[model samples]
Structure formats: structure tokens, C-alpha cells
Target: MLTNVATVIWDGLNPFEFGAACEAFGLDRSNDGHENIPVPAFAVCSPTPGAVRTSMGFSIEAPHDLGRVAEADLIVIPAMGHTTPETLPDGVAEVLWAGYDRGARLLTLCSGAFALGAAGLLDGHECTTHWMYTDKLQRLHPEAKVIPEVLYVDAGQIVTSAGTAAGLDASLHIWRQEYGAAVAAQIARRMVVPPLRDGGQAQFIDRAVVEPDTETFGSLLEWIVENLHEELDVPTLARRSLMSPRTFARRFRAETGATPHAWITGQRVLRAEQLLERSDRSVEWIAAETGFGNAATLRHHFTRVRGLSPQAYRKRFAC
Candidate 1:
């Protein structure tokens, strides 16, 4: 039902985030066997309807003014240079509130969540922003629950995402929900990006820097990823790492921001998703291949992680 989309542009906007919105909603891909799907009427709107300067020292012009948002079924706020609540442009908050109050979904990419917070729209909702700004967003809006490590948080009518490329993940999530995984995959194919990604922003966060000469566990992590089908419990991994089980667990958590089991399971699920999408294999085969032991166990884990059964995922996304 998301047939109309509008993106709001402001001065000093980040071009990458703005382009993410446009790539997700603005392109007309009807020629790609997607005629059954509704092509959203997309527009770019500005506060004053003129050339808007970007953070990269360039300017881009939007075709419409703030009024365009009033007619959209969804409104997108791209990340801008000024993320603080006190620096919002005139009437931007009102426009966001009006669109949300009228039953339209509001999406923010990265620091754009700050604008939503400034509008008081995120006060009681779960939201997120770029990791660099997560602390500031929470400090500015104590009432909002800020989840810093996820790709995006979908809180009913308001959707917020983490930094940069996570915007694509969030946008594909919306597409998958509105249409289906097939449509999202098709769009992703056109964009030359993965249709689905596992885990969260925590994987991208920088860990404590070790000295260049210090011995690390990089090879162990790579081996785990390459052999997700094997048994990789804490004791086995600890033995492989040449450390005590307790010490290995502590060090893994510190370096990865996720426990060993959680990281391994996430990688298995990611592999299962790829297999489900790319091959015509049975659930039982995929379960065993991904180290889930059996179909029921795979279903339990897949459902808990992806909110969809393995069969349903294959049906929606199989190539």
C-alpha cells in the first residue's frame, strides 16, 4: 500500500543517505517483471523549494516544497550535518509530525533520527541512529529507547536506522514487508547489494586496538566462519584458541561484542539464508548443512531470528 513516497532534503545533507532513500523508493523498475507491484510515486521535497547545499560542498535541488510530504504515504528524513535537536530547520518538525499523525510512516536514516526526536515523535518509541551519535541521541532524548547496535529498529509508524549502508538494509526491510522477499531481492539485485544481511552494527564497531606485534585470534574467527557446519561450542573453540574456556569466552565477547554461541548461530543462520535463497534444497538438507542438526531445530532458530519459517523464506526468496 506504500504507493507514494517523499524525501525531505535540508541544507548540509549527506548525499549517501539521501541517495539510499532515492534508490529504495524513487526508481521506476517496472520493466523488470515487477509490473504486479505498485511503483511508488516518489518526490524530493525541500523546506524552501530550491537548491540545497550538501555537506560535500555541492548543491542539489528538489522538485517540490514541504507541501509534497503532506500527500505522501511515507516520508523519509535523510541524515544531515546538524544532528542536534536545537538546530532543526523551521517547520521541519511540524511537517514530520503532521505526516505521522495522518497515518503515514516516517523513516530516518542515521542522524535523521535526531530530527524525529526533536519533533517528540520518538519520545516513547524504540529508535536508533549512527553509533557515533547514539549516545548523544539518548542524552538529548532520555525518554526514547535508543538501540545502538542493530541495523534498524521498526517501531510501528516510525523506523530508524544505524549509520550509512545500514540504510539499505532498513529500506529493503520495508520493501520486504510491503511486498515480499522476492520483490526486495529483485530490487537488491538491481542495486548490486545483498538482499539480506545477518547480525547487527556491533560487528562493525571497532574493538580495543592491540599492538601490531601482539598475538590475536583473527585466524580462529575466520576458521569459524568458514566451518559453521561443524560443532563449535565454547569448549571446542577454547581448545582451538589455546586458552582456557573461561578466558576464551571473555576475550571473544570483548573483541566481538557478542558471545561465541551468539556469533556462531548468527553466522549459521546467515549461511542458511543464502542457501535457501540460492538453491532448491530441502529444509532438512539446509538444516544439517548449517549445523542446526534437524529441521525442527532449524525452524526454531530461524523463526526466532528471522520471524519466518525456513519454508516460507524459501518460498518468498528462492532464486
Candidate 2:
């Protein structure tokens, strides 16, 4: 049902993020054998409708203005340099509000979430920006729940993603929702990217270890990741850390921003994803290897976390 798409550009645009929106929705792939699925009519619009300089020192012309957003079913806002709520252009906030009021979905990439926050669209929503700006975003929009760890947050009408390449993840999620996994997979194949990524921005965060001080917990985390096939309950992990269960649980949450059980489950799921993508193992074998015990348990947690069953995921991502 999503047919009309518009990508809004502005001064200080990041070309890669803007190009992500164009590649996702603007390309005409009707002759690629998926004829029944219709490609959306796409447009690049700017507030000034002229030469817009990018952050990388090049200029690209936008032929349309804010008027194009009015007819769009979805509007994508790419990353811009100035991310403060007060520094947005003159009428960009009004135009965004108008589109939201009329029921158009808004997808923002990286710092573009700042524009939505400035327009008050992110007032009560769970949103995100690039990891580097998440603190500033939270500081600026105190009302918005800014989660810096995830690739994207889908708050119904407003979808926000982290840095440049994560825009592809969010865009493919939209396609997977509107169409199905097959269509999304085909598009991802054409783009030479994975249809689903396992973990989140937590995997990309820089965690420096300062010898014996940080080595205890950091080493424990690495051990858990390596030995996901073992029994990794809180008590076992606590014993391994030489702390009481109660103390270990609190310290684990403080260190990882997640409970021990949640962290272990996430690691198990990530291991399962790697096995599914690389090997020809059966689901039951993979479940046991990842410490899920059985196929049903694996299916339950995998479907809840990845939005697809093990078989379906293997069918799409297996090499």
C-alpha cells in the first residue's frame, strides 16, 4: 500500500544516508522478475529546491520542494550536520508536522532524528540517532526515549535509525512489513547486504580494557560469548565471577545495560544466526549447539527476536 515516497534533503546533507533512501524506494526493479509488486514513485525534495551542498563538499540539485511531501505515503529524512532542535531550517518543522498530521509515515536516518525532535514529532516516541549523538538527542528532547543501542526503533508512524548504513536495515524492515520476507530478501540480494542483522550498536561500541581492573567482567563476557553452548544461568555465571548471585546480577546489569539472562540469550541468538547463515545444520542441531536445548525453544526465542522462524531465516540467508 505504500506507493509514494519522498526523500527530504537539506544543507549539510550526508550523501550516503540520502542515497540509502533513494536506493531503497526510488529504484525501478519491475523487470527483476517481481512484477506484481509495485515500486513506489520517489522524489527528492528540499526546502529551497536548488543546489544543496553536502557535508562531503559536493553539491546536488533537488528539483522539488516541501510540496512533494504532501503527496507522499512515506517521507525519509537523511542525516544533516546540525542536530540541535533549535537550528533546523525555517519551514522544515512546519512541513514535517503537516505531513504527520495528514498520516504520512516519517523515517529518519542518523542526525535527521534531530529535525523530528525539533518539530515535536518525537515528543513521546521511542527514537534513536547515531550513537555519538544519542546523549545530545536525549539531552535536547527529554521527553523522547532515545535508545542508543538499537539499529532502529519502529514507533508506528515514526521510524528512526542510527548511523549511515543502518538506514538500509530500517528501510528493509519497512519493505519486509509491507511486502514479505521474499521481496525483502530479493532487494537485499540486489543491494549485496544482509536482510537481517543479528545484534545491535552495542557490538560496535568501543570498550577499552584497562588490564586487571576491567579484565574480570570483560573477560567473563568474552567467555560467555565463546561458550554459549554451556549452561549459562545467573548462578553459574555468578560462580564463575566469584561473586554471590545477588551481587553478580546487579553488577552484570550495571556493566551491560541488560540482565545476565537477557545478555546470554542475545548471545545465543547471535550464535544461532551465524550458524544458520553459514552451515547446513538442522534447526534442532543448531538449537542444541546454541544452548536453546530444543527446536521449539529456539523457534520461540528466535521468532520473538528476529521476526522470522529459523527455517525462514535459513531459507533467506543461507550461503
- Whose TM-score is greatest here? 1
Each model's lDDT comes to 0.85, 0.85
Question: In model 1, where is the ten-residue run with the lowest total lDDT?
Answer: 207-216
Question: Against the correct fold, how does model 1 do in TM-score?
Answer: 0.74
Summed backbone clashes in each candidate are 0, 0
Displacement of residue 69 (Cα, Å) in model 2 is: 0.5
TM-score between candidate 2 and the true structure: 0.69
Mind giving the per-residue lDDT tens digits that candidate 2 earns over 1-319? Answer: 6899998888899999988998999888878876755689999999899999999999989999998889998999999874565678777888899889998899998889998998889999999988888999999899999999988999988999998778999999888667655677778888999786545665456653212234559889888888888999989988999999999988776565577888788778767877887789999999999999999999999898777898988887665
Candidate 2 — which pairs collide?
none
Model 1, range 1-319, lDDT digits (tens) per residue? 7899999988989999999999999888888777755689999999888899999999999889998899998999999854565778888888998999899999999898988998889999999998888999999999999998888999989999998888998999888767656677779998998777555777566742232221467788779878888999999999998899999988787666578888888778877877888888899999999999999999999888777899987877676
Provide the TM-score for each candidate, comma-separated.
Answer: 0.74, 0.69
Q: After superposing candidate 2 on the true structure, give the runs of residues whose Cα lies further than 4 Å from its correct spot.
A: 207-319
